[model samples]
Target: MTAYAVGQLRNVQMNDGIVDYLHGIDATLAPFGGRFIIHGGTRETLEGSPADDLIVIAFPSKAAARAWYVSPAYQVLVPLRLQGAEGDIYLMEGVGSEHRATDILDVG
Candidate 1:
């Protein structure tokens, strides 16, 4: 199943550290079959508070997503991201093709 790594960046510091992080991230992602589905694109907030920026990356599976996040190469760039931006990042599993609303609803 596919998995996603989503990040909601706030209070970004746009500096050399962030530039290095962007340049090196692709190489780290390639080995884990991760691809950027969305990277700092325009967004409209339909609801809730707005975020400064959003990033979404897709991976082959949940494990792959987790593995990539903790990989040695990615770890090297973590500090740069942290120093460049304040945000929340997380992994979420994707639903299968046959998924239905009832699959997640608990209406007993």
Candidate 2:
């Protein structure tokens, strides 16, 4: 199944390290067939408190997504991100076309 890396980054420093990290991210993703689906632009808060930047990257599979995140190429850029922003990032499998809201009831 296709997987996604979803991140909600906040308190971004917007410094030179961040600039380099942004410029270098695509190259790190290329090896794992990962591509950005959302890169943060503008949004509306329907409820709850205001949100941070939303970033979603699609990968062929969970393993691919995990590999991409921990790969040496990406790891090299980690410090820059740590210096630039603080947030949560995670990977999740995508549902199939026939997936239904009640599917969760079937999970073990």
Candidate 3:
């Protein structure tokens, strides 16, 4: 089954080096089968607090997600993301077509 990794980043203070970091990071993700499903979009907080940015990326699989997270190439960008923002990142197993009905049934 495919999986999707969602990142919720809150940038307290953005510096000028972010562009360079993103350029390199984007290329690095391709090795591990990563795709940018959502980069930055308009968001509204329906409930709790609000965040600065909402980043959502999708991976080919859970293993791909894990590999991309810990890969040395991507690891170098960690400091950039940390210094640029503070947020939570999560990975969730994607529901395939087979499970679509189950998801609806469960919701019902």
Q: Highest lDDT, which number? A: 2
- The C-alpha stretches of model 2 lying farther than 4 A from their native spots are none
Each prediction's whole-model lDDT (CA): 0.92, 0.93, 0.78
Sliding window of 10 residues with minimal summed lDDT for model 1? 43-52
- Model 3 alpha-carbon drift over 4 Å, by segment: 44-49, 100-108
Q: Give TM-scores for every candidate, taking all chains together and pairing residue i with residue i.
A: 0.90, 0.94, 0.79
The C-alpha local distance difference test score for the whole of candidate 1 amounts to 0.92
lDDT of 1 at 76: 98
Q: Which is the better candidate, 1 or 2, if ranked by TM-score? A: 2
Clashing pairs in 3: none
Q: Kindly report which residue pairs in candidate 2 clash with one another.
A: none
How well does candidate 2 match the true structure in TM-score terms? 0.94
* lDDT by residue for model 2 (1-108), tens: 999999889998899889999999999999999999999767878888865888999999999999999999999998999888999999999999999999999967
TM-score of 3: 0.79
Backbone clash count, each prediction separately? 0, 0, 0
